[model samples]
Target: MDRHYQNLVQKLEEITHLNGVMSTLGWDQEVMMPAGASEARAKQIAALAGVIHERMTDPALGDCLNELKEKNFDHLNEVERCNIREALHSYELETKVPKRLVQELAELGSRGQGIWVIARQENKFSDFAPVLKRFLELKTEWAQRISPELKPYDANIDLFERGTTMDMITPIFECLKQELIPLIEAIQSQPLQPDTSFLQGRFALDKQEALARAISQDIGFNIAQGRIDVSVHPFCGGSHPTDVRITTRYKDSDFIESLYSVIHETGHALYEQGRPHELGDVPASESLTMGIHESQSLFWERMVAQSKPFCSHYFDTIRAAFPENLKSADVDSFYRAINTCKPDLIRVEADEVTYPLHVILRYEIEKGLFEGSMRVDDLPEIWNESMQKYLGIKPPSDTLGVLQDSHWSGGAFGYFPSYTLGAMYACQFYNTLLREQPDTKKNIASGNFAPIKVWLNEKIHRQGRLYTPQELVQRVTGEALNPDHFIGYLKTKYGEIYQLG
Candidate 1:
């Protein structure tokens, strides 16, 4: 390799390490940092963001990239080729935007998160409105600056998942909404739902934490490299391929909150740990889009963790976790309780059958928010309307409605669609997995995820940014992104739960 390209790769590695640091600090702020450290953390992050932006957009970096653009440059391997392509793409997008804008957005996003934390607690949108509006303005400007050829919204969506656009997403979302609304209504009228009484009671934190650790181990998350903590909003974040950290929220009166969330966050940690040792130029260390990442967590959380076979195998472990509370609880009863088909205000807590409806509602509003059809201040009213339209219930406060998610507050405008996209990815992957290994359910039921995780690592996680989400889905599933798979999954699963006659 030419010294130019070599230097570029080294610089990129440095940038990635810096990014890992930022991730660590961000994770700490959420899980372990004292409340008074918010301001310092924001500035620290802003500085890191500025440094990263400078490195990414440097003229020398652009020159090295231009030099390496030739096909024969240094006889570039596939890894180098991918790195150059993605790096150039990132460079073009970042350099076009002003550094001030980059720093400004970072600072704004940090402050906005703080405001969101407060506003959600207060259940008042007014406290968050001004920063939210500022965030949108900055985001719109940043999007416009990056790709003047495309609409700001489409450009923004492309950031999370490559080549994804409002036009492409709109039809898919339409199909999802069309199917989900009636299905939810029908399921709502059904009588054969799971009894969730087993999930409610005073679940001790120690037991829940112990259960979380055991399940995390079962699912291949290394407890030594990763640790679980409690937080207001559950998430998994960390600095490097090793040293992964995740958080889950607990309700002493509710078990489901911590139970499934641990599984979901563990999905993220496993993927992170599974990243290849070769860093920088290799696509393996690079995570796929947020949507694809979510699919990993959700697949483990819903497709495996919540499956009937799995519950039976682990019922005794679960009972042991809440031995006193679940003295009379059994696998079947626990299964019915967790899969209970009921509408709820919180999206995270919604039953699997009604989950996509929540996604549909957010997708519509997100589209509206991006297209200037929706204003930040009007979000609460619109959220209530969509909640009623989709879920047959309304949130009494914005806290349970639009303010529930930290995505928008963090200046992530085009990320909401990924939740449903992840579900769709999960369905296609799950179907393909069943076909590939008929014993997948059997293995999961036995609390062994090694074989499945290995398959996913080789076929999916290992590919990482080497493939776009579209290519990843097609390659793994032998099919394109199909909502039919997801719909079928819901119908089959819910059919059993609701006994649709």
Candidate 2:
């Protein structure tokens, strides 16, 4: 190994340790921290961010990277070469923004999260607007500093999923809007609908937790290494892959929210757990992109957990969880209730048929915000209008409208598209998985996910950041991201449920 490369690797390890600390703090802030501790936590996060920024932008790190790039690399392996390449990319992007700005952004993110929670609870968008406006201002400035060539929104998008742009995403979404509107209308016009009454009964939280945990464990989430808890919003975050933490809020009247939140986040934990263990110390070992990461989660939540075979396999468990309520419920009705399509206010709770519409709504609003056509104060109105136009429902309050999501408060512009993109990717990947493993449905029906997990690990999980999202898609499915697979999946699945032609 070259001396400079070794130094670079060592530096990255230090930076990763700091990141681990920051992630721990973040998880604590969301799940366990007292309200009185918010201010101190914000300062701690900001100081850590400043130190990380200084280290990442250090001129010596640049010199080391340049030395490695300038020297002969004939002796190095692929991972070594990738490390230097990824490090150079990170250094360039991080150096663009000033350290002070980075610290300010981190501080604001922490403070904004607390404010957003309060505002949403109170149904008051005004309470959070000023903080959100400041966040947008900082994010826009940071985007400009990073790359003036790329549009401000695209610059932020690249941070999550590189090689993606509005030019590419716009048409894909337009295609979805064209196909889905008619499909939704057709379903609504149907004479018969699924019996969702079985799902409206009181479900015990302890039983829900047990079911969630059982399913999470059955799908390869190592409980010994991971823990599940409740949060205001469900999320998966941990300091290390070995210490994976997942959270889902429970509602006594609804169980799917907690059950599927576990399944969805377990998919994320699986990807995090399956990351190349050999390269754990390198930044290259992290999941490649947010889109790819979301694909894993959506795969489990939609393609696996929501499938007929899965329902057949797990019906008894669900029935047992609520014996009094589900006494009359059968597997078919249970499946339909779980897959029922109702255009709703919440994105996280949306059914598969209407899920992408939620993402599309956010995508358009984000475009307006970044393009200067939309103002912060107008978000609530725009949100209500879009809901009425796209989903045929209007949010009566900001709590269920503009204040519903926690992304903007955290300054995560251009991140919503990943959810829809991931759904498409998951569908395409499922097509190939079924083709390669003919007994996959049988295995899933029999409570055997080893085959499914093994296949995903071989095809997607172990690759880590070695390939971009597009490259990985091509390598696995032999094509670029095709939304037709997702549309076809929805059409076929819903056609069976609603008897649509």
Candidate 3:
């Protein structure tokens, strides 16, 4: 490698480590920090982000990039060229924003996350609106810096999934809305359903914790390298890939709440753990996008964890975790409860069949937020109206509704579509996996995830940011990202449960 390339790589690696520290602090704020530490955490995060941004956008980095480009004016080696090109791309993007604006965005995001938690707990949007306004205000400024050519909303989207614009997402949303509403309506009309009462009761918190750990381990999350904990919101976050940590809220009345959530986050953690060893310091090792990452989690959570095969293998272990509480809860009932299709207020626990609709609703609101078409102050009314139109049930309050997610408060406007994108990718990936490994479900029934993990590591996890999300999808499925595979999988799997038209 050229001297310029080496220097740029070192700079990026140093930045990566600094960013990792901020990530650890942020993770603690969300999962383990004391309630009063938000103030200190916000300052620390903003300061670090400011320093990182300044360094990334430094004129010296641009000079180094120019030097490297000049060196390769004739021809370029693939690896050396990719490294310089990636670094230069990052520097150009970072330089687009002023350092002070980046700091403000970070500060607003951190404070907003804290405020959002309080609003969620209190079931009030008024408490969170101020923070949301500040964050989104800065978010608009940030979006302008990234891609002045696109609409502000489209620019924000490219942050999460590179190359994706609001225009691209609109059709994806349209396709889903066109097909999913009728499917949800059909499921609503069906009489058949699981006995979800089995999931609820006065189960002990200790039992929930124990079960969470066991399920994480059973699903191939390394007990030595990773741990599961509880938080207000269920999520997976950690400082390092080796030290992956995840959290899920437990409802004493509902076992599936914690159980399936663990599996979901575990999916994310496992992907982090399994990223290619050689690409550790390269962007290639980083996750491609929020949506692509979500598919890995959902693939394991829904396609595998909730599958009949997985339940058949682990029902005894599950029963053992809460034997006293579920002595009479048959394995079949627990399985059915998990797979039951229903429209629910909570997005996290919404049945897989109805989950896409929740994402679509969020996408609509988020697009409006960015395009200046939707006012932050009017969010509650818009949120409720959209929910009613989509799910036939509207939130009576903001907490269970507009204030439910932690994303927007933290300036993640373009992130929601990824969940549905992920679901579609998950379904498609699962189909491709099964086509090659026909007995994949049977192996899950027997609790052997090694083959599946190995398959994914080879095909998906190892590629990382080396390829864009669409490229990765095509590489894995031999075609571009498609919803038909997702819709087909959903129908084929849930068809047995909801018996679709």
Best by TM-score: 2
User: TM-scores for all candidates?
Assistant: 0.97, 0.99, 0.96
Greater-TM-score candidate between 1 and 3:
1
Pitting candidate 1 against candidate 3, the one with the higher lDDT is 1
Report clash pairs, candidate 1.
Answer: 194-336, 195-337, 196-337
Q: Candidate 2: lDDT of 367?
A: 91
Q: Rank the models by TM-score, top first.
A: 2, 1, 3
Error of 1 at 495 (Å): 0.9
| Every candidate's lDDT | 0.83, 0.91, 0.82
Q: Cα deviation of 492 in candidate 1 (Å)?
A: 1.1
Give the range of the ten consecutive residues with the poorest summed lDDT in model 2. Answer: 277-286
* Model 3: lowest-lDDT 10 consecutive positions: 72-81
Higher-ranked by TM-score: 1 or 2? 2
Clashes of each: 3, 0, 1
Question: Which parts of model 1 have CA positions greater than 4 angstroms off?
Answer: 71-74, 279-284
Determine the backbone clash count of candidate 3: 1
lDDT of 1 by residue, 47-117 (tens): 99999999888888888888788647457766667787788888888888888988888888877888889
C-alpha RMSD of candidate 2: 0.8
- Candidate 2: global Cα-lDDT? 0.91
